[model samples]
Target chain A: MKLSELGEFGLIEIIQSIAEKSQNPRYDSWRRLLVGIGDDTAAWQAGDYIELATTDTLVQGVHFNLNVISWKELGWKALAVNLSDIAAMGGIPVYALLSLALPQDLEVENVTDFCHGLAELANQFEVAIIGGNLASSPDVVITITIIGFSKSNRILKRSTAVPGEQIAVTGFLGLSSAGLKMLQKKTTLDNETTNILRQAHLRPTPRIKEGQLLLQRGVNTAIDISDGLIADLDHICQASKVNAQIKIDRVPVHPLVKVYSLNQGVCRGQLNIIAGLPGSGVIANAD
Target chain B: MKLSELGEFGLIEIIQSIAEKSQNPRYDSWRRLLVGIGDDTAAWQAGDYIELATTDTLVQGVHFNLNVISWKELGWKALAVNLSDIAAMGGIPVYALLSLALPQDLEVENVTDFCHGLAELANQFEVAIIGGNLASSPDVVITITIIGFSKSNRILKRSTAVPGEQIAVTGFLGLSSAGLKMLQKKTTLDNETTNILRQAHLRPTPRIKEGQLLLQRGVNTAIDISDGLIADLDHICQASKVNAQIKIDRVPVHPLVKVYSLNQGVCRGQLNIIAGLPGSGVIANAD
Candidate 1:
């Protein structure tokens, strides 16, 4: 069967089955593991804290077009996505290992610029770039593995959203999708709105503080919206075994997205779900 | 200006410089970090034990050829290479995260076969497949990030080899290279010899127990021979600021390699350095 028929989640299930089969009770590492295979990050008990690990990969032409996004922004987005996963788990990122597969003829300056972007974000979060691997490939592929820490009791998860709990989203959504649309169509808009939308798609802010705040306030369920509202919500629903109802009017859309949507024949108060782009979408559940 | 011109080590230097610049004395993680970039793994203090993390990527057509290797072997090799890095650090691998970029049209059985290989190796080490990312790409790219643990005092390093210490190899060298050559050339040999050589190249074992034993024996410097004898020894020499001299006659070559080498018009006492192949070449230094 083709991978397209099996789908991503189906593929994940296959891997998870193999992973689960290997969990021997004899291994002490299995005893310390709190979460594995299916969460934003795999978490394990480490002394007084829970260690969180997550990996993300970006392949050229599939995830980003070099002509559309700068190498620095690509670097920023790559790490940012992993940061968002940690944030979703209510953890503080500490270290990262980057593995890069680059074309042999790619410019050295591009790589340095990529590192600069990664360092700039890493420095902000106090994350150390520890170690990684470099390989030669036909196209650029960047895979980042990030490790983080969180309080054992305060860890947020996608599988614990209680039924009838109210969901609250941090920051505006759909702006990134709109920004991508504008870039694809070369839409002419006001400079401020254009910058806002473009930056929203190109560079996203991970809700690290907001995630911690949510965890502190006794919110236990959270997921980063990398795959838009519907898909991400489906992940929570599937993991938590609960149905969700999102009021289209209640979903927050960025004003810039609204402006862009208006120019593109979309109605106000419509739920604009940016299906496949990493956008400023952080959602949490509060009882 | 190109990546080829800068070379892998030069690019790594640029990354390490950026990483070092971002290291703030104020961050507590830095205080706990014992080793960062330029080593087999990055290590940091995690309570009483030191945590070691390493990442490796295998790109299709560059690091592997589908025509030459099965998907299951590819999976085993991907994890095996990372395991070797952890082994070189004298650490016990505990957890792993896999990031895979696969072609959309790839067969589902191929992925399952790959995972079967990974799970088989992972179970042997008692390592948990904690978390990872998957994306669609034009070709298969597998990057694995493995985390291991070692006692703080027992951690081995490549940079600590002394001036006059004798290097002891844990296993035979040049077998994997010979295996690869045999496969590439489609050389017909005795079935037993061919199987031995092919297995060495396809399923090179990571010397986890050997590494631990070396550490227990107070051997503080070690390296795995992934890039053959000359290149790996060069790494130790560069890192330790010492030159090395290997007696060609003293370097151990497998009987199979010797047979193959003899057929290829090489002397019995000649040093067969199989560069750029993951092989059973674990070398350690004891005072």
Candidate 2:
């Protein structure tokens, strides 16, 4: 069977199962692994604080087209994806290790520009780009591993929410997808609107501060919306062993998203949000 | 300037300079980063023990060819390189995060085979295969990030050696390089010799136990020989602000390496040793 038939999520599930069934007893005993494959980050105890780690990869053709996005934005998005995983765990990101596979003919200036973008985001989050590896390849590949720490014993997880809770979101949804649609179509719009959409697609922000805030406010279950709102929400439901009833009208969609949908001759309901949860907040049931 | 002109090491130097100059002040104040770049691993303080991290990437054409090496061997080599970094730091490797970029047409069986190889090595070292990311790409790319811990306050650093101290290595050198040559040439040799050379290339062991023993013995400075013996020794010498006088005869080489070199009509001296140091034993100079 080809991996394409199984898709990315299916492949991950198989890998997870293999890892779980074949775990080394000595490793399990020695390393106090608090979390492993299924969570947003793999966590372990390191003294007073719990250490969190997560890794992500971006392929040139699969993840982005250099013709459409600037190298700086590509760099920012690379780190942002890993940071989002750490944010989902409600941890403070401390260090990052980058591994790059670049084409032999890549320009040095483009490489520097990518670093500048990465640096900009790292500066914003106060994450130190500690170390990384570089190699030559047929295409460009970027992998980032982020290490973080959480003082609170209570870590927000995808599997802690109840079925009776009312689902809510932190911010607007579908803007990034709309932005992607605009870019794909090469739709010409007013400068302000185009800038808004382009930035949304090219440089989506990780909700680090918001995640920390949610944890502080006693929200026990959360996840970052990277793989569409519905898909990510489904992950939370599956992990928590509960079903969700999402009111379509209650879903937050940016006004510009509707415009993009209308222009593209598609329904707004079909468009997926790249960030901001389908329903980020939860209201407790009265029982 | 093209990145090819700068090469891997030069590019790393440039990246390191940029990262050092663009460091976040808050990160510096809050997180105590002990070692950042230009070392085998980046290190930080984590309560009683020091935490260590390092990452390495293997591209299909640049690092290995599937025609010459098995998927399982490729998987083993991927983790082995990272383990070598941890060993160089005198740390116990605890967790690993893998990020893979594979072509869309890759077979599911191949991925499973690769996982089996990775799991085998992870089991051997008792390092947990915690989490990873996978994406579709034009070629295969494997990136492994290892996290480790050091109990001792003393860490073996390249810059810590004194001018008078004699350099040393742990095992035989040039075997991996010789193995590569044999594979590249598709040379047919005796079964025993072929197995030895092939194993050396495919599943080179990381000297984790040796590193810990050295640290216990108060050996202050050491490094792994990944980029040839002379090149790596040069790093130690340059970092320590000293000069080295290596006796070529003192270098350890497998008997088959000599045989392979003779068969290829190349001088043994010209064939670089991939592992083992020039002079592993520390001999104090009587000044």
Candidate 3:
């Protein structure tokens, strides 16, 4: 069967099953692997602390077209997505190992620019890009593996949400999706609106501090919205074995996205703005 | 300038320099980063123990051709290369994060076989395949990031060798190189010789146990021969600020490689069989 039929998530599920089934019984005694796959970050007990790890890959013509996004933005977004995974688990990202497969004809300046953009974000998060591998390829591929440490013993998990909790998000969503739409249309948009949408797509800020604060304040259930808000919420619901009733009117939508949707003759309600979590809140339902 | 001019090593040096210069001083106080970049693996203090991390990428057409290698061998070799880095640092590999960028047309059975091969190796080493990201691409790219724990405080380093030390390698090399040549030439050879050479190329055994033994035996200088022996030895010499005079006659050439070289009208003396190091001995010069 074609992978497209299975989709990315399905492929991951199959791989995860294989990994779990093939796990050595001897490893069970290690007492280090606190959590493995099927989570935002793989958590393990390392000495006095727990270490968190996550990996993400961006491919040319698949994740982004270079014609639309510059090398700098590509580099920034590649690391950003991985950092978001760590943030979802309330961990402070520490070290990153980057692997790049570039075409032979790729310009050195472009490669340097990509590194500079990655370094810029790494500096912001205090993550050290310690080591990586480079190889020649037919297309550009960037893979980043981030290692992080949790601040507290309690890590926020999607599976821990209670049924009666009132779900709230920290930032407006659907901006990136709208931004991607705008880029695809290539229509003439106001300078401010274009910048707002492009920046939303190109420079996503992982909710590291917000996630840490949420955990500190006793919030035990949270997940970053990389997928659409409803889809990610479904993850929490499925894992927690509960159903959610999200108030559609309460979803925060970016002003630019609203305008962009209206200009494109689409209803504002149809815009999926609940993606990219800056912070999320859960209140206990007193039934 | 194009990246081809800089080559892989030069590109790495440039990136390493950028990473060092851009390090945030806030992370300097973490006291966990024991070692970073320009080494076999990046070592950091994780709670009470030092942890090691390294990543390697294998790209289609660059690292291997599908016509020459099966998916199983590709998966095995992909993880093996990363484990070699951890082994080089005298560490025990614990976890692996794989990122694969595959063409959309790739068959499901091919992917399943690849995962099985990877899982088989992971089971052998007791290393858990925790999590990974997969994306569609124009070509296949496999990146493996390995996390390991050091056996001792004194991890082997390339920069610690002394002048006049007798350098000895644990395993004979040139087999993989010879195997690649045979594969490329499509030449028929004896079954035993073919199996020996092909196995060397397909399934390289990382010297993890030997590395731990070396550290226990007070050997402090070593490096894996991924590059040619002379090239890798040059890294040790340059890092140690000394020159090495390898006795070519003392090098152990594999019998199959010798026969292959002879058949190809090449001199056996030209073979640098000290490439892959399960354990390399470097004693203090008594001069």
Candidate 4:
């Protein structure tokens, strides 16, 4: 029967029944490791460490519009988003598992290309592709979960922020938002600026190396820029029991961004232009 | 401007501009780490251990059709599918951050309900709701990335399977496939079977505990069942440089599955049904 007729749950049931054979491989042995599949969370004791985990799912037409990105570009951007999280916690990345749900009619060639794109980036970062789930779905949905290690002493957390810490960012801003405008208006961008903004949208380079460096150097209280700068910083402020002072003018807009803002018809400084509402919407009070 | 107008880069540019502060207590030391926002992946070290990370996307119409699911159930399943990947690696679950894209017309109530459903499952699993992203789009899509940890010595990898190790699974089989049949046919399940299959579909219990147990017991090769059994097991076999001798008769079937197969007009034997391949979907030679 068609997927619609089966309904989502019904389809999941079909999938689950087939998977029943895979349970309890190491069951019944005491000290057989402490976690199993039946609880709210899985735990393990490896010498001095116990770690936590989960994954990322960015859906098509939802997280991003196809008309907004190239397949290669999308592949890179999707993975980068999660890497950013690990960076937030002062964790270095070690492993990753990716799950893809694509419509049947999607081009097979594109699938291969997509994997190649993701793999190329993963390889550069030394992130191992540990294998993942591939399924036929109605849309292009790629979900990934990464596992990393911390020395137990250094896993940074949101709750640990202090009230007096300074607020700072690494690179220029407003490029990606500008890229979105270009896509929507179907305007042409020069090679340099196009490359700049494209990198922002298609390939968000999470500050992995820097994050690790910070953690190693004893930096704590951090978050990556998945949400807008002000919003994410607000997270630090709130979690740390402090209110942040934002020098909006201090925001580091890339040269391309500054140019795009001035040359393009789109208003660059407009607060509403930011996706996470850096100074508006839900996070308005944040900055 | 709408997201599409932002193109890929433009959106990111604006995001960078607005996100400015971080709570990193170590910020003074790693003035360099001031930006864990790398070009793609973040490289941070937790204590002495390093982590690797990334995320992917899923969408409706583009990913799954919602008419086939209750909104609340969709919320549960969306996260479940991603967590399944973490399980595949025998990793621990810890925190999650979300980036959701929804059409403006969708009600705040629907959004809240969806979040409640997702959060309930997350909290139940001990996976923290650390942070999230919200945006406007043509479809309703939620993207989440969960962070987890593992020690180098204890991690179980798909590529690490040995040829002679016994391969096994955790739970029953074929019920999900059967449940889909029931839903498509609009067939009602009695209260008992209904409970079984409905849970299978709407809220799949991730095998986190089992994976940790496997890892603790030092079992090296494993994967979660997101794809069909034959398909998923084949991945292990191929990666491990071995062919499996799966006893079609050894796989378990839930009691509800047996009842449904008998009365639901499908060809089946108790053992074969238990092993999945209800209607000759499993080939004798392939076995």
Model 1, A1-287: lDDT tens digits are 99999999999999999899988878977989999998889999888889999999999999999988999998888999999999998899999999999999999999999999999989999999999999999989999999999964568888887777876687887877777777877888889988988888888888888889888888888888767776777788788887776666677777677767778875432334633322222374210
TM-scores, each model vs. reference: 0.94, 0.94, 0.93, 0.60
Per-residue CA lDDT of model 1 for B23-109, tens digit only, reads: 887997677899999989999988889999999999999988999999899889899999998888899999999999999899999
Q: Top model by TM-score, which number? A: 1
lDDT of 3 by residue, B160-213 (tens): 888667786768768778877788888799898888888888888888888788
Estimate, for each residue in A1-287, the C-alpha lDDT of model 3 and write its tens digit: 98877787788888988888866656841356877777788888765667799998998887888989988888888889989888888888999988888987889888888888898998888899988888888888899999998868668777787756768675778787877778877868889888888888888888888888888988888777777676677777776777777665677777777777878976654555433332223421100
lDDT of 4 at B135: 48
Off by over 4 Å in 3: A28-30, A266-271, A274-287, B28-31, B266-287
DockQ of each: 0.86, 0.65, 0.64, 0.06
Weakest 10 consecutive residues of candidate 1 chain B by summed lDDT: B278-287
Q: Which regions in candidate 1 have their CA more than 4 angstroms from the true location?
A: A266-287, B266-287
Q: Over the stretch A22-81, how does candidate 2's per-residue lDDT look in tens digits?
A: 575556423588788877888887767788999999998888998899999988989888
Docking class of 1: high
True contacts kept of each: 0.90, 0.72, 0.75, 0.02
Better of 1 and 2 by TM-score: 1
lDDT of 2 at A196: 87
Residue A234 Cα positional deviation in candidate 3, in Å, after optimal superposition: 1.8
lDDT of each model, Cα atoms only? 0.83, 0.79, 0.78, 0.54
